[model samples]
Target chain A: EAGVTQSPTHLIKTRGQQATLRCSPISGHTSVYWYQQALGLGLQFLLWYDEGEERNRGNFPPRFSGRQFPNYSSELNVNALELEDSALYLCASSLYRTKVAETQYFGPGTRLLVL
Target chain B: GIQVEQSPPDLILQEGANSTLRCNFSDSVNNLQWFHQNPWGQLINLFYIPSGTKQNGRLSATTVATERYSLLYISSSQTTDSGVYFCAVEQDFGNEKLTFGTGTRLTIIP
Candidate 1:
């Protein structure tokens, strides 16, 4: 089975602009999660989507939002991007309803550089 | 919110050596995961061990939920093991968001 896939391996956007990163979950997976890894920092949770609904979110601002499609693919949108927004955006997928201990497979991630 | 702490913030080892990394949480957690971030910035899942011990080749992990701690062991380490190892945990209730530790940065020399 194919692993989680993300588009735009590298992106460069100017400050105040908007950026959209995409992720495709593995086959048969129903939950998609978004995380941000700022340089020299640990991964921070951003959002969680399951069965086409937003199940939970982190302490991120409203400007950091995203949605999951019918096919379980997801899109993370960062509005009013700031230079501090430069980081690697990761997407992970897992089977819904499984035990919380189930491992989440991650994608290669999209590297966003806000100029 | 649960607090996750990782020990030995930094470590350096020669190739073929062995090492152990630890993570301690302040409260009970419903989930515990280990991830390795390579130089290219990919978060690779190493294990999702809430309890018990599991091994995958040279990498292995053990989570003693009752003790609120987990351990990751690397045996006969290789240059490919050089990176940052992160331990993340999710509480048993509420929003169930994953809280990450500061991570242990490891460098392996040839």
Candidate 2:
């Protein structure tokens, strides 16, 4: 089975620009999650989507938002990117309701460098 | 918000050594997992142990949910094991959200 996959392994954006990162969940998986790993902030939860609907979001500002597609794939959008927005954006997926598949499988991650 | 703390924020060990990393959460959780972020930054799921103990290869993890803490062990460590290890948890059953800890940086010298 293919693990979670993310696109644009590396991205470069300038201040005030918008960046979009993509993720494809494992087959049959219905939930996707997004996280940001900054230099000192550690890994902070960004958003959570399930079955095409955003279920929860973290403490990030309104500039950070995302949506899940019908296929369970996800996109994280960071608008008006600031220098501090630079970080490794990670995507993960899991089976919606299962005992063994509850654990999330992560992608290689996208390294976003906001200038 | 639940707070997760990892011990020995930084560690250095020679290859073939055994080491233990600890994770403590401030509250109850429905699930707990361990992940290894390689030098290249790929988050690899190491364990999905919410309770009891589970082992994979020379790596094993035990989560004492009742105590709100978990331990990850690396035996016969290799240079490939050099990376940041993270502990994540779900606040409720069927919850897809995860809060991550600060992480433990491990460096193994060959």
Per-model DockQ against the true two-chain complex: 0.58, 0.61
Per-residue lDDT for B2-101 in model 2, tens only?
9999998999999999999999999988889999998889999899988999999999999998999999999999999999999998887655688899
The numbered model that scores best in TM-score is 2
Candidate 2 residue lDDT tens string, A4-104? 99999999999999999999999998999999999989888898899898888888999999999888899999999999999999999988784343888
Q: Over the stretch B1-110, how does candidate 1's per-residue lDDT look in tens digits?
A: 77899999999999999999999999988888999988987888899898899999999999999999999999999999999999998775435467889999999999
The 10-residue segment of model 2 chain B with minimum total lDDT is: B90-99
Output the worst ten-in-a-row residue range by lDDT, candidate 2 chain A: A94-103
| Minimal lDDT window, size 10, model 1 chain B | B90-99
Stretches > 4 Å off in candidate 2: A98-101
Cα shift from native, residue B90, model 1 (Å):
1.8
Pairs that collide, model 1: none
lDDT of each residue in A5-98, candidate 1, tens digit only: 9999999999999999999999999889999989776788899998899999988899999999999999999999999999999999987664
